[model samples]
Target: DNEIKKIKAEYVRSFLFENKLMPSTWIVIRIDGCHFHRFSEVHEFEKPNDRQALNLMNSCAVAVLEEFKDIVFSYGVSDEYSFVLSKDSKFYQRQASQIVSVIVSFFSSAYVMKWKDFFPFKELKYPPSFDGRAVCYPSTEILQDYLAWRQVDCHINNQYNTCFWMLVKSGKSKSEAQSYLKGTQTREKNELLIRQFNIDYNTLPIMFLRGSSIFRIKGEDSVMPENGTFEEVKQEIILSHSNIIEDSFWKEHPSILC
Candidate 1:
């Protein structure tokens, strides 16, 4: 009995060494696909935006939101998604390692498991994986800044890709397109897309440009017409591609933060 107890105690005690994240702070875990460039090529994804691939990613994010109640919102672009936990959440005691590991594992597994549903004819050559890291935001301002930074990155990358592809289609060599685009400002790119390609930058699909945002909204309680009985309804997760940087978004979804 003494030897058995010692073994159990030693193993159990080791887990506690991983520290929990600071409480009352917004915890965001961002996960990105590992080596997705090669994965996309091997799978022959459609350029600019692949509808099936993006849907598969969104489905995985929804699964994560359903699995973890503490995650109030999520924003994803390309091969990466960022999940935000409410400031007051105590899920898993905010244990960073456990939280990160569980989310990444679940998302990666879901991507693999649900591939068939999204891509019926295509084959999944092998399992795809993701890497995740958690960061604690001390204030809403800082959190918004982080979110804004990501959105800016998405804008820059999408604009560049749009120009590069248009140039390639317009008979410019890949290296020529690369050289021509180097050091060109955002205005130049928009003008090029307009004058040369006849593609208006503003008319692009919002999803491809802005990426995806997923957040929950509370449901209003309902009253029965006959008996005057009241019933509560479950909240819902809403997926959108609207601007998240402005005050209007935070004001509308006040429950997302805390």
Candidate 2:
């Protein structure tokens, strides 16, 4: 019994030490497409294609690296671009803001240039100015705000769904209930929903249901389950195959659903 106690204590201590020593300083950089105006006339070059979009995204990455060569450690671009640093560098954050600022400026200027090149004199209407003012170098908060704004502004036509569950006693259409639940209008709102409600673009309907349970349990009973974390619940929802959770599977297939 004494030897068993010593082994268990040693195992616990080692686990704690390993968890404590894990690095939390790494920086994750995500770069995705910004906004694009509809072409007045569908030129072969003007129409957005995966190949063209990828090329443009690559160009943006190159532009960022060229402007801030000293700060970037390593970067990659696929569907979206990302950079990972061994550790967070304040310099890189500063440079990221600068790069984003330049990209925004270039986007604005390029819009005008492309309009002139394509239309010449056909009374081209420029898209509305991104409500936010342009900056030479932006702060992280500003960059995040701008990115969020751009996302909503760019994808205005896309539909988002919110889910709701009421007790069997309540009589309301799920759609009507979900409408009252509210869709997020901003990136901050979405992030908060993901963190608090455990729902996001990638979350399945079943996952949403599990999240709903956890959310309700916490809200009403102040109780959490011992067997699962929020993420585990989310994963379980994804793995399950119930017809009632069809919406969840559809959420993961945006392109097909869209």
Candidate 3:
């Protein structure tokens, strides 16, 4: 039996390829919703920006941060999120597949589990799914650039969606809305929203404009009422919608990179 087990283990494990992330480099596991458009449509999600859906995403992200201590930070918008693991992390021995799968699977399950909490009256039409990929950024500078790129994407997509939905709600067919928005620059879109819809694009919620950033900070550790002998510091996860592309955020949260 031992000889047979050894033979099977050697043969089967040999077929499994290892995809280890680069050492001394930050690991970014980005997960995106699979076919979220149809899911949203079937679930009757509010167009442009669904507060409940966005909140649910935020909650799931918070849960992920809480579960994975090695994940230093996360940035999310729309139906996708990018989680950044510390460069020195040894989680799953830095195996790209394990890290990506575990995070994505946990996030997907968290979304499903927390759905009812956020959308108390609405039933989830189906189990929402996500796809994930892992990439290594060799330096903090490159990681910042990657996050900035995602945030910029979030801004652009949000602006377009806001305009598109506003036009549709104003009785314009979806085709007409698309045509009107086509070839229109940022300036033109803002003009259209103000002139026609009286909506100030800048006045939109910061969460929609900048997306959400989840991370941990050192704070007072909780203790039972009777065990007040001493106080200690502990890591507490927090969510923010501030501008991560700027230096001030990094300066304020210096421990994130450390």
Cα-based lDDT for every prediction:
0.90, 0.35, 0.93
The predicted structure with the larger lDDT, 1 or 3, is 3
Q: Work out the TM-score per prediction.
A: 0.90, 0.26, 0.93
Tell me the tens digit of each residue's lDDT in model 3 across 163-242. Answer: 99999999999999999899999999999999999999999999989999999898756565566764555788889999
**C-alpha RMSD in Å of predicted model 1 compared with the true structure:** 2.8
Q: What is the per-residue lDDT of model 2 for residues 119-141, given as tens digits with 9 covering 90 to 100?
A: 45455444422211212212333
Model 1 scores a TM of 0.90
Task: Using lDDT, give the best candidate's number.
Answer: 3
Least lDDT summed over 10 consecutive residues: which range in candidate 1? 221-230
The order by descending TM-score is: 3, 1, 2
The lDDT of model 3 is 0.93
Ranking by lDDT: 3, 1, 2
**Sliding window of 10 residues with minimal summed lDDT for model 3:** 224-233
Q: Which stretches of candidate 3 lie over 4 Å from their true place?
A: 1-5, 220-232
The superposed Cα distance between candidate 3 and the true structure at residue 146, in angstroms, equals 0.6
lDDT tens string, model 1, 1-258? 999999999999988786788888899999999999899989988877787899899999999999998898899999999999998888888899999999999999999999999999999998898999999999998998899888888899999989998888789898999999999999999999999989999799898888899988887754566767655447788999978877788888777775
Between 1 and 2, whose lDDT is larger? 1
